[model samples]
Target: MTPIQALYYFVEARPTRTGPPNVGIGAILLIVAAAVFIAWVAWLWIAARPSSGGEETALNLQPYLSDDELETTKLNRVLRAAM
Candidate 1:
């Protein structure tokens, strides 16, 4: 046999059937990235939801009424009639 072939056999450096070593690491990194992205989207969705506080004020009916006729009972009646 040639010297090169003999040397190769002595070193026992055979071809590998598996792919590159970094392939598994790359897959794991992609999975982690997907998880992080999903978590961020979910956080944004939750933060955008309306709160259950009583801070939402009703539309001012006083604008449609005159100064002399400005009354809550009158406004409620007018609103009910309009609706």
Candidate 2:
């Protein structure tokens, strides 16, 4: 009569089937989905590959500006404005 007992009974009870279980379409769909996913990943990997003839650009970093100094300067400006 309790909720747990009812749930347990529901899970334990099996319905009588007149025919065989149909899983052929489901299996085929699963295989197709897996193949599509793999193909997509392979395509992305191939498309994103860097060209052999392209030259790599050098990164330019400012030597005069330090991150810590920049942060301190911003904090000082905010504090001065607040005062």
Q: Judging by lDDT against the true structure, name the best candidate.
A: 2
Cα-based TM-score, every candidate:
0.39, 0.38
Candidate 1 residue-wise lDDT at 64: 69
lDDT of 2 by residue, 1-83 (tens): 99999998998896877996776788989999999999999999999998897765655643656889878998799989999
Question: RMSD in angstroms, all models?
Answer: 12.0, 13.3
For candidate 1, write residues 1-83 as lDDT tens digits: 99999998977877766766866887999999999999999999999999989675667833566655766768778999999
- Weakest lDDT window of 10 consecutive positions for candidate 1: 61-70
Which candidate achieves the best TM-score against the true structure?
1
Candidate 2 TM-score, true structure as reference: 0.38
